[model samples]
Target: MRLAELSERSGVSTATIKYYLRERLLPPGRRITATQSEYDEEHLRRLRLVRALIQVGRIPVGTAREVLAAVEDDSRDQLSRLGTAVEALPHGPEPDESDPSTAVGRRTATALMRQAGWRFSLGIADEFPAFRMLVGAIAALHRLGYACDLPHLLPYAQQAAQLAVADLDLVEEFTTPAEQVEAAVALTVLYEPVLLSLRRLAEAEESNRRFGGGS
Candidate 1:
């Protein structure tokens, strides 16, 4: 196929294809004439991968190129082992576990981390802002006589993890190994904002359902 056809088929811009060619992310095409070149199916597949990484994964071009090189080196294997390695990349920022304070504060922090589906050791509780926030929220609730039991939160955490894993599996269908890593990065960066916004919207609608229209 020609560059224009490839772009049209892949929903990628011609200029982006040219940029990928210049970056050597896509292999060279056939030289059909002095100026005209013909790209094949492999180029199309590679472009799909590139689009997933750049637009969906949001990877920096330099890092994405390195990831593509890894894919190339591993392309001949019976299994796409490098792709699996890429998907196994960490999804979020690592925690810092250097604090030594203990007692009620630490226990509350640990419980909140549990609620958030984080599986790190208790020693790392001081490192997660979400963990700390959860602790504070639960503590405030308790002081206001609205305390929740840990067991009650456990099921919610489990269900949430199941949903997240399902969501990642769904995204896997359209992504390559490098793009998988990129998508994971993108999910980590954007999911919180998106989910928080949705949560507020849902809460508003539920409030209307419960209190609005004189019902």
Candidate 2:
């Protein structure tokens, strides 16, 4: 495809596409002439990945470049490539420093992960941004004077572990490392709402079952 076609197909402006090429965020296409280049489907795939990293993920250009490099690094194994890609994504923001629960939550988060047997899932405690998000959530409950400790959270952890396994199973259905990694990233961001909504629905059903309040 030509630059204009690539731009239209990718829903990105030609100007922005030129900028991405100059930024080396997207690899240049094959040279057909001094001023013309021919792009293929791989360029299309990469353009979307670059856009997702920048626009949806809100990662910096530098980080996105590093992530793309990692994704394209054939020397690395599939798991390593995917791990690097995922770790590059932003988890939610850190809990407020002023909140005492931030400290308490960090401790609780560590203990909970250890009890759940996932402390080493990323080869270190407090490594993934999701771990930080967990800390913030636990901290919030603690701030509310609730027992948001390991015992209280273990069942949820067990269920989440199962979901994690299922997520990996789905990612593996893709034939390539890049495709699998893209699926992993997409599922990570997109499925949280699905999971959360289902939880709420389940709670409603269980509540109605126990209380006889529904038709």
Estimate every model's Cα lDDT from 0 to 1: 0.63, 0.82
How many residue pairs clash in all the candidates, one count each? 0, 0
- Encode model 2's per-residue lDDT on 1-215: one tens digit a residue: 99999999999999999999999999999999999999998899888878777776677888878777777778888878887777776677888879888999988888777787674653565667678888898988999998887788999999998999999998889887777777777667566678889999999999998897676
The model with the greatest TM-score is: 2
- Deviation of model 1 at 100, angstroms: 6.5
Show the colliding residue pairs in model 2.
none
Residue 183's lDDT within candidate 2 is 75
lDDT leader: 2
Q: Write the per-residue lDDT of candidate 1 for residues 1-215, one digit (tens) a residue.
A: 99889989988898988899999878889989988799987788778767766675577687667766665664545134434334332233332234322234347657655667577535455544445555555555555556455776566567667877865785586456544544444454456567779879988888988889523
Q: Runs in model 1 with CA error above 4 Å?
A: 69-156, 168-200, 207-215
Candidate 2 is scored at a TM of: 0.80
- In model 2, what lDDT does residue 173 have? 94
